[model samples]
Target chain A: MGREIKLALVYRDMWQSSGKYLPRVDQLVRVAEPIVEMGCFARVETNGGGFEQINLLFGENPNVSVRKWTQAFNDAGIQTQMLERGLNALRMSPVPADVRKMMFKLKKIQGTDISRSFDGLNNPVNLANSFKFAKEGGMIAQGALSITYSPVRSIIMSIWRINILN
Target chain B: MAGIGRPVSIGKMVKGIRERHPDIIIQYHGHSTPGFSVASSLEAARNGADIIDVGMEPLSWGTGHADLLTIHEMLRDAGFSVPDINTKAYMHVRSLTQEFVDDFLGYYINPKNRYMNSLLIGPGLPGGMMGSLMADLENNVKSVNKWLVKRDKEPITQEQLLLQLFDEVKHAWPKLGYPPLVTPFSQYVKNVSLMNAIQLIKGKERWSMIDENTWGMILGRSGQLPGELGEEIMNLAKAQEREFFTGTPQDLYPNQLDEFRQKMKDKGWDVGQDEEELFEYAMHPQQYEDYKSGKAKERFLEDLEKRKAAQQGLTSVAMPQTSNSESNVMPQSMTIDVNGEKFKVQVAYGDAVEEAKAEASKEEPKPTSSGELEEITAPLEGKFYLTKDSSEIGIKVGDKISEGDTIAYIESMKVINAVAADKSGEVVEIVARHGDDIEEDDVILLLK
Candidate 1:
């Protein structure tokens, strides 16, 4: 119970959950040192998921952003993480296994130390593949379970349940 | 998990996961929506969760993850050895984030996403998707209201439409096999529900307008559904003759890393610092292409400027010109207005050429006859074009035209509005030539 709890500040998710755009690479660069100095976070989520797509929307090279931003954190003795959508691999549709593996390699080379990967449907097959690729590509793969609430036998569920019960 | 779980349920889940595999580390990621995430975080930590994902304020709470400062204090109070936060550094990061929100991104965020909506608990939509969902809901509501107004019916409010959509999602989720309401799948369910609501509003049947992507999700293209597809969708799929996939989703998307690498080679693009650029292209082909071409940034900045101007209550900038010499070589004088103050400015292209000025004077409009000729003045200030972009033929001398006829087109603000004739007449002479920048009340055509 006395163990030091590691806190990873989800910077990418904070903006994405609140607004439509991510801050420019220059803006992120300015704040990266201040974030490391905050002294509570063990890790900072640099980019992934919609991060690259949002950077493209701003007409900036996401590769450059990830490299410089993660380097800033790594230099400050803080680890960096990226959100990965398991089989989808940073996009909505399914990605080829070869490209998915290369994503982990590229992200790791860009200075990201961890990859927090999740399958939206909680498919174990997808998660297993993500962990294998991420670890093989030199990243600490943090498998995620997407949780949701489901009421027991509500009006809609009752109909399906009744058909089975009968 | 996505932070939507109750505290007790989260505790049980974390404990259960730890019990099953004691060596595996558990990190809890919960959202602050529906007011349960703070308690959920505490419960998870107590139940052997190794780490907690927290968001820094002023970007915390609302639909984002729980606040770092609050969670750290709470965890420390609960006897956990949480790390100390530098107050000054925290304050600086908070202000920097606020500055970003105020700068431009604030315009696109729905204020509703910043508050815990208890109403969302029933539909169980994830907090991360709530921001974009509300944005799409706002847009969809506007379109629906506009349609209703056109039909002379009572318009619905965003709140009303959102409630309807939630209801439809509740219905559709069960029908679509209750896939975990997460990214991609949650969006798929929300979109189909939104379409159903819109169709019913327009007096059309549900499932009348299903998109291919939604069909793909329903037919097992993403993966095997946990539950069964509803009878209606199944019947509709059968009627539409849509094929259902029984194979693994990844098998359908074979290895294409080499294909993308070859594409980057053909385009002569650098593979970047360890092929990161190529990875971006392989991931999102269209968006990466737009970014490489510089079109994305141009449009993004343009939209930001427009939104900023609108927020500042400024209309499109207009210059009040006093006069402009017809000759290109002459000094043109105009009035520049800044904050309601006017300053006279004169700009000269170059030293005046005598022969060039004479030629410009000669090109000026002349009377074809000494008789009374009617002047067809421009109704608005714009670039006067003798024909639309699609046409080449124009009104010429001696051409007969009828009243209410479109004699020429005037392009203003990218819209080509037809300039109609006031009375039927024969064109005696053309005054405003093609592509001429004519002002209001300027004679564009001479009629007889």
Candidate 2:
């Protein structure tokens, strides 16, 4: 029982329109920025395209671990698409009590309508790799990719594997 | 435990004490016996516990292992490091402290300690946990013959085995939390005996079922087995009480029958049918059938199913219910019916209650044709929640939400996601409600 790491995801909702994907750019920033600054995790898009939007955040060792994040939400009556991620990654194992109670608090700000299971989010690893290598980067492994921080040396594991673009 | 059926937990007590006395650094140590445990003691250490109480056994999470030596060995298999164990604590103490040994004997005989009460476990012996488990396994796994015939499904995964145990232990005593009491743990071992007992030792010629040597450690080295266990199980069967194992006497393997008898006797049962009668029953196929009508088996199963169904802290009465016919035991609003079974629907607990209130206060998003602008409010306090709003595909007005759908999100930082119906017909009017900062029992979306 090292210090229990509690990850709270504040994500952006995407609207589907005219047989195409529409990203809620404003809500993404609104929900995620404050959440990230608050020392929790949130998603951020580099540019356009709903396809690339999923890569905003995750860790390196494992997936976002919705099990840890969602039980608190579920137990507290907060809704989550955490279950959907069951197919994408191993759901987070059950956390202990005090941390469970704390994660339950952080989830308060992140709770919203779950659009789908596992959130069908993208890997930020590919986004960074694509930016680093341009068009050469392609066909990323969905689960292996993640949103990694360079200075803090943190990487939010991707729910899906990814082969970095390039 | 100082006394049987008293339900003691060193883990919870240690946690409570530590929270109050974070600095009470007592020189802590621990040891597990064959039937004794370090789980409770180790749990204490993890949560500010200092000393480890050494008794007799080793460590295996799911069901538990043979004796103390076996448990420690299994800990190595599970990737846990046991660097600090004092394997010879009792041996060293025995050599050096004659006075301490005298105190221990005095303590064992004091009668005030109630230590002797723990030695009376057996068939139909009221709270004979092993007996209870046998009855449970038989009850839950209906068609024992069919199950045995087809028992080779996926082997129970280590994680699954652990989680199942956690659920059962948690169920038996709600407040016990993660590291539950030994009573429930013992039952778990007994229930999964076939799965757990057959320890696969990697390079061994074959996985071995628990034999006499192991059984000695499981019950207690000093406790009766070949004599006592045999007597207890036989007497329990004779008494027509709930029994987990049943089969043709001819089907019984040589060591199995003896092992079973010893286990029964260890709990103080009487194998009165006699060795000759047992051997006679063991060899004759037709005579065994004459005694096997199984009306008792059916009754045992019915009682067990009832217990499992009502794991939620309340004594359950066996009554079949469907969604249509309602329970009149409680008022309609106060109780909720899930498929005819009734549960008292109380207000949401902890952060959920606060989040529910916050949902009621949230601001409503701009109204659209399919998406309703009516505010979804929190019925109680809870952390605001979201159902994995993956790339937001907005909800439509015609979509109907069952009772627990994600209608809106709320959080006083511990948010609760209020699941409301998407379509209660048309969103007739908009409330500045979609994300309005709401409070207790506030109105969310009016489903008009």
Chain B TM-scores of the candidates? 0.69, 0.20
Q: Write the per-residue lDDT of candidate 2 for residues B344-411, one digit (tens) a residue.
A: 64432111222323432343443333544444444333233333222234344455455435555543
Candidate that would win on lDDT: 1
Worst 10 residues of 2 chain B by lDDT: B57-66
Best by DockQ: 1
Worst 10 residues of 2 chain A by lDDT: A54-63
| Candidate 1 overall lDDT versus native | 0.76
Return the lDDT, model 2, position B217. 22
Residue B309 error, candidate 2, Å: 53
Q: What is the C-alpha RMSD of each candidate to the true structure, in Å?
A: 15.4, 30.6
lDDT of 2: 0.28
**lDDT per residue (tens digit) for residues A14-45 in model 1:** 98888788888888888898898888888888
Off by over 4 Å in 1: A151-166, B314-448
Question: Candidate 1 chain B: minimum summed lDDT over ten consecutive residues — where?
Answer: B348-357
